[model samples]
Structures are given as C-alpha cells and as structure tokens.
Target chain A: MSAELKKALYNISALADLGQAITSESVFHEKIQSVFYVITGTFLANRGAILSYDKSADRLITVTQKGFPPADLDRVDPEKLMSLGKNEPFLIGDSPVLAIAGVKILAPLWVRDEFIGVLLLSGKLTGSPYTQEDLELLNVIAHQIAIALNNHSLFMDLSDKLEENRRLYEEMRHIYHGTLQAFAAAIDAKDAYTQNHSYRVAKYSTAIARELGWNEHDIEGMYVAGYLHDVGKLAISNDLLNKVTPFTPEERAEIRKHSTTSHNITSKIKFPWQNVQDMVWHHHERLDGCGYPEALAQESLSDGVRILSLADSFDAMTSQRPYRKKMDVQTAITELKKCLESQFDNKIMLVFCKVLEKEIKGELPEPDILPYLDRDSDLSVISSMLEAIIQELSAP
Target chain B: MKTVQFSVTSRLVGDAAVIYPKGYLNNLSGESLVKECGIYIGKGITKIVVNFSETDLINSIGISLLLQIIEDLKNIKGTICCTNMSKFLQDTFEMLGLIQYMVVFPVESDALQYLKVGKV
Candidate 1:
C-alpha cells in the first residue's frame, strides 16, 4: 500500500477506537477530554479549544482544551466571545493581541442541521502553517465529536427514563401492600376476638412456605393470602361471627358463605394476587368432600390453598375462644396428625407439625394473641387509622 | 387531539321523550355528552335517539363514557337508540361492544319507526 493510504487507514482505525470509547459506559467528561486531546495533539502543533452552546444562557462556552489555559476561558464573558453561529469560523488573531500572534485555523462544530459549537486551533508555537490535510482531519474529528455528544445526551435520557419507571413500580407496590393491609384490618374488625389472627397466620404460613423451599414470589403470595383469607367475612353479620355458642346447621351454613363472599370481594380489585383470592375462598375446604362452599376435593385445590387450610386449622385449634379452652400445642399437633388425609392435606399437615414443634421449642417469637377483645364501631377511629396509613405512604 | 361536537335535542313522540345528539365523539365531546345525558335522565327522559350525521371520529374515551351512560340508564329500563350513523361509526360501535345494549338504526325515521312500535 502507498504511504499516504496507510496513514489514512491508521487515522480511520484511531477514529473508530475513539467512537467506541464514546459509545461505551465511560464517564462523560473523560470522553470529552479524550476527544479534545486526540484531535489537537495528532492533527496540529497549535493550541486548540472546543466551545459548546449554553442553551439556558444562549451563549457559547468553552468545554475542553489542548495546549491552552483551561481555567482562563472561565473568567471571560460569553457575549464577548466571537460569534460562531452557522458556517462562521472566526480566526483567533483577528485582533493584535500578543497571545494570538500567528493563529490560523478555526473549525465550527456542527451535527445534523444545528451548530453545536466550534473548534479553535491557534498558531503553532514553533511557527508552522496548518496544511489542507491537517484542516481536513480536524474538521472530520469535530464532526465525530458532535455525534458523540449527541449520543451521550441520548444515553442520559434513557437513564432518566429507567429511573422514572423504577420509582413508579416501587410506588405502586407500596400502595398495593397498604390496600391489602387495610382489607385485612377490616376483616379482623368484623369479629372482635379474631383481630390479630390474620397476622399470626401470615407469619406461620410464610415460615412453612420458606421451609418447604418455595421461591420468594410464592412465599410472598402465601403471605398475602394468610393475612387476607377471611376477607369474605365482611359480608357476615357481626353477631353471627362472634357467637358464644356452637352454630346450628343452618347458621353453620350461613357462616360458611363467607368463603365465597371473600372470593368475590378480592376478585374485583386489580392486583397480581390470584392465589390470594383462591386461598380466601378455599381455606375452609377439606381434602375429603366435606368442606363447605364448592367442597373442592384434595386433587382440585391449589397447593397454596392446601397449605393455608392447614395453617388456618392449626391456629384455630390452639387459639383460646369462648367455646373451647385453648388446646395444648402438643394436642393440636396430635389432632393434626389424626386427620391429615381426612380433613387436611397430609404433606402440608406434616409441615405444620414441624413448624409447631419448632415454635414449641421457642425457635421463634411466641404466637401473638388476638386483639379487639372489646368492640367499638365509632367512625372516628376507623377514619383516623386510614388517614395515618395514607399519610405514611405519601410522605416525601 | 381530535374534536368531537354534538347537540342534544328532545322530540315528543307519543308518551316517550326522544333525545337527538350529533357531533364527533372523542375525548373533548364525550364528557359534555355524558353530562347532558345525565340531565336528560333527571328530566325522566328514558328514551333517546342519538343522531351521528356529522360525527366522523370516536376514540376509546368516547366509548367508555357511552358505556357509563348505558349502565346508568339500565336501572330505569331507559333505552338509547343510535340512528343516522355512518357505516364506519356503526362498525366502530359494534367493535367496542356497544351495540349489545343500544339499538342501531340506518336513518332517523327508522329509529322513530321502532319507537312507534315500542321495539326500541
């Protein structure tokens, strides 16, 4: 190859390398400085500087420099600088200033149809005239620099969009969680003695699910269901819910209607929680065909509902109530063992037993007692609770 | 960004109140149309004739507001019959599942004919 062609090929390869750097995740200022250094150091021995427009101030400002005092330009006012709009390129030594004695080339930076800035190359300190080849190369470099700047701007825009989407998803998730909590509270409020039952059920269900090697997503779904399983109880009469004596068969059937009620209630809300609705509907269902509502058999029910059913039964048996003195934790385990296939999913029952054993050993916090031992339906309390929760969520 | 404009006028037909509406149906016009329908509902005008002779555009917001009107009027056994609709608007109404609740007529007289027969 001819020497001139080889030199041209080398310059092309160097330019491509610079383009790659600008495209990479390198820091913004470093890329700008590298472009300034490469263009001025390789193309000429003259002092060089780059100026970009300050859109807010409507003036050109120096960005990067080579062989020039980088800080001195800062003290100069923008309006006093030579106008470099469009195709206008002003020479440095147009005045008789000593600093610009033999200055020569001035290349304006442009990309697309808009003029972004200019490239100012002054006289060579060793007394040299900038050749046509040098000017050509400098012009090409300035064009590439403009392209790089635009690319960086786009990257910044995409970065901002990603940040905005992340913030939106986070805020939506928070609102969803708060809504679920309020629904759980409403259910608890319906039955005075069952106030904190949902919270404990959620804790136990989440523990058993984690021990069973479920993924974090499934465990989270189970957590929501455990807290909201009795949501349908909102439709039941408060007197029926807190009855001091055992229910008649007809009253028992009326009580069982809450499962379907809860299902219908949850299905109306838009949430990524289909399993929560199923668990609420089927938590009373037995492995055998004796469960109320649809009486879904073991084979038809989801694994989540099966696990929740076991947790719900265990918690009810151990909890102290008007009808039955609290069963010993050991007795509850034995009862769970006796009715595994008949009333509960056997695998889930076994996990429940293990979780109970761990609890008895004090491996975790003692199960919380139910609240709302006293009843109050004053409008002020409910309104204040809702307002406090909403304020916490909307805080800056 | 499209503009939809319409007017609601009432005609006396036997013992029923017939309402006539015209204009494009988009975001800008859908709100006013819905509000006017509510006023008609207050006046005990349960039967309606919506004339679309001058309308050419309907967006999702317009369709949603029309659905709201249908739901609101359903409890009173009130009916809205759409007439003088262009072929394009008829197709759009069908695509949005609005035809199931509101009857469609090829011309104003056809809708009035149905009202005479109590078939609306």
Candidate 2:
C-alpha cells in the first residue's frame, strides 16, 4: 500500500474519532479535550488550541490547547476571525493580528452565518508542509467542530434559563407560604384563646399526612388546609368567639356555620393542590353522621378531611379555650382515643398515635406535635400512654 | 473485534524508564502513555522506552499522544526508544516520518541493552 493511501486512511479514522468524541456520554470538557487530541494527532502538530467565541462577553475563550503560550491565544480577537472565510483553513501569512509563535494554519469555524470559534495548529512534527489533501481534511474537521461548539452554546443557554426558572419558583413558593401564615395569624387573632392554634394544626396535620405516606405535594396541601380551617371564624363576632359562658342552642347553631363559611371562603380561590376546598369544608363533619353541617358519614369522607379533623380537635383539646381549661397531654390523648370511631377514622387515629409515640420516644427528627404541647407535661407518661394506644390500634 | 482498554505501567532499569503500554492505542485513554512518560521526564530521567507489544492497533488520537511524548523528550534533550511494535505500528510511524525522531528495536530487551551500553 502507498504511503499517501495510508495517510488518507488515517485521516478518515480521525474523523471517526471526532464523531465518537462528540456523541459520547462524556462530560463537555473531556469531549472537547478528546477532539483537540484528535486534531493534533492527525496533523502531527506539537501545538494547537481550540478557542470558543463567548458572544455575550465578546471574547475568544480557549476551550483546550497545547504547545502554545496561553497569553498569545487570549489576545486573538474574535472580531478579526469573524471576517475570515467560514470554516475554511488558511495559511497564516504575516497578518499583524493573526501572528502567533509557530502557528502555521488557522481555521475560522462557523455554522451557517453564526461564527462559532477558531482552530489553531502549528506546523507538522515531520517538518512536511501541509499538502492540498491535509487542508481539505482540516476543512471537514473544522465543520464538525463548529457544529459541536454551536450545539454546546445552545445547551448552555438552555441550562442557564432552566436554573433561573427553578430559582424563581422557589422564591414564589416562599412568598406563598409567608402569605398563608399571615392569613392564619389574622384568623387566630380574632379570638384571644387561640393564639398559634392554626399554626399547630398545620404542623400536626402535615406530620400525620407525612406518616400516612402522602407525597410532599399532598402534605403541603394538608398544611394549607390546616392553616385555613378556621378562616371563616374571621366572620364570627369577637364577643361570640371569646365568650366565657356556655353557648345557647341558637349561638351553638351559629358557631356550626363557620365550617360551611370556611368552605364558602376557600371555594372562591383557585389552589394548586387537589381537594383543598373539600377538605376545609368537610373538616367539621363526622364519621357517624352525628356531627355538624353536611354530616358526611364514613366512606363519604376523604383521608384529607379525616386528617384535618383529627389534627384540629387534638390541637383544640390541648390548648386553653374561653369556656374550658386546656386538657393535659394524657387527657387529650384519652379524649382523642375515646372519640376515634365516632368522629375520626380508625386508620388516621392509628397513624396519629404511632407518630406521637415516635415523637415521645425521640424517634422522629422533627416532632411536630411535641414542640407545641405544654412544656411541664411528663413526656415519659405521655410516651407510655402513646405506646398502649399504638399497641391497641396495631392489633389485627 | 473487541478493543482492549489502554493502560500504561512503567519501571526503572538503571537510569532509564521502561513504559509498557497495553491495549489498542486509540482514544483519550491513550493519554496515560504520555502521562507515564511525563512522570519519568519530570524526575530528570533522560531515557524512555515504550514497549508496544500489547498495543496492536493505533489511531490518530494515539498518534497525537505519541507526538506529545516525542515532543516532551525533544524539549528535555533526552532519548526515546520504541520496542516490540507491530508491523502496522511500524509502518504507520514510518509513513508519518516519526521514525526519524526515535530509535526502534525488535524487542524490549534489545532497547534496554542498547540504553545500558549507550551514552546518557
């Protein structure tokens, strides 16, 4: 076989190398470095560099290079290269701006009208001048390199935009949570006895939902429902809400209207989570059809509504109220356990017990309910009570 | 045919470094050969013998890396000896005119013997 044919075969294989490098699953830097190696190997040039055009910065940044002074490559102007023939290899002929030590060939890379970058190569290691075939081969390699660089530029732009969108979404979510807290504060402020009542319900409901294996989105919805469950109490008079005496039948009937009122208020706005309105509206309904407005019986209730109902009553029982003193932690647990089949779902009760047990035993990383309970209460006693309840509920 | 993964292992015999490069010399993995030689070059050892018995195939990327090693040795005014090259490897090197830059031997022991008796 002739030496020229061998050289030709070598150049063709070099093109194959370029294609493999460009399409490989390797990271961007490694791929570029591989391509640079292919170029240097094909031409047998001891030195070369691949510079990419950073249009935003209007500079030619060196992507990868060897055997050249980096400062000299940094000084090569993108504007001057843009005026050269697109993707065509040319001999550097004493041009003032193109002058660099040992550089014999320069290819200004382009895809369509967009100038991508330039490829610089020093003389061959063999001391042989580049024949017409070498220049042609370089042209083909230069085109492939241009497309790779352009695709990379497009990808980088997309990545930057995606990062910006992610940041914006996080900020908006933070603001949304802040606004919800402010609304809960206003609702709790309507009556003096219920300070942070809405906040506790939100945390407790979130914990229960998490324990039930609800996903983050649904847990977030449960939290929102807990915060807004008493939003309708905002419409009730402060005198009636803070009244110390037992309510007359008419007054009790008026108080029952708040859940329906909560449904009415929440139904007006669009929420991202499913069943927000239904959960807030049906929170006061019971499993046995004996409770207030709508009186949604078992099976008619959703897990979300059941979760909110249990979380609300537990917080209310443990907290100080206008007409009644706050129940201690043990009494509150007993009250919840006694009311389970009548007002709450049995499964939800079990999960609540298990979570509380976990909290008391120091098993949970963040004990949502324990932090809000009365600080003077004996955790050991509460933990024992929870263990018994959990056993009873866990029995097949 | 399955391509062998490229690897480079080196040992010092007297003042020279004998680098054994195994597998198909094709892609960026071949950079290991250059790095192996560079370690000796950095240590002020003037002689490098690359035994290519296991490297049966070579590509442009491989050629580029070989050029880097040759250039590195030239810059240090040192010697490079290539031993146990396959026929294809020898012909490719000869056609590219790279044979003029480095001494070649039929086997690794011959190169080691030559380096032992030759001037530093």
Q: Per-prediction fnat values?
A: 0.00, 0.82
User: Per-residue lDDT tens digits of candidate 2, residues B71-107?
Assistant: 9999999999999999999998998899999999998
Worst ten-residue run, lDDT, model 2 chain A?
A91-100
lDDT tens per residue, model 2, A256-361: 8999899899998788998988888889889888776887778889999999999999999998998999999899889988888899888998899889888888
Predicted candidate 1 versus true structure: per-residue lDDT over B39-114, tens digit per residue: 8788787876667776665543355456557756776898888877777667655543457778888777788778
Once fitted onto the true fold, the runs of candidate 2 whose alpha carbons sit more than 4 angstroms away are B118-120
TM-score of chain A of 2: 0.96
Task: Give the TM-score of each candidate.
Answer: 0.59, 0.96
Error of 2 at B9 (Å): 1.3
Number of the predicted model whose DockQ against the real structure is largest: 2
DockQ, all candidates in order: 0.00, 0.82
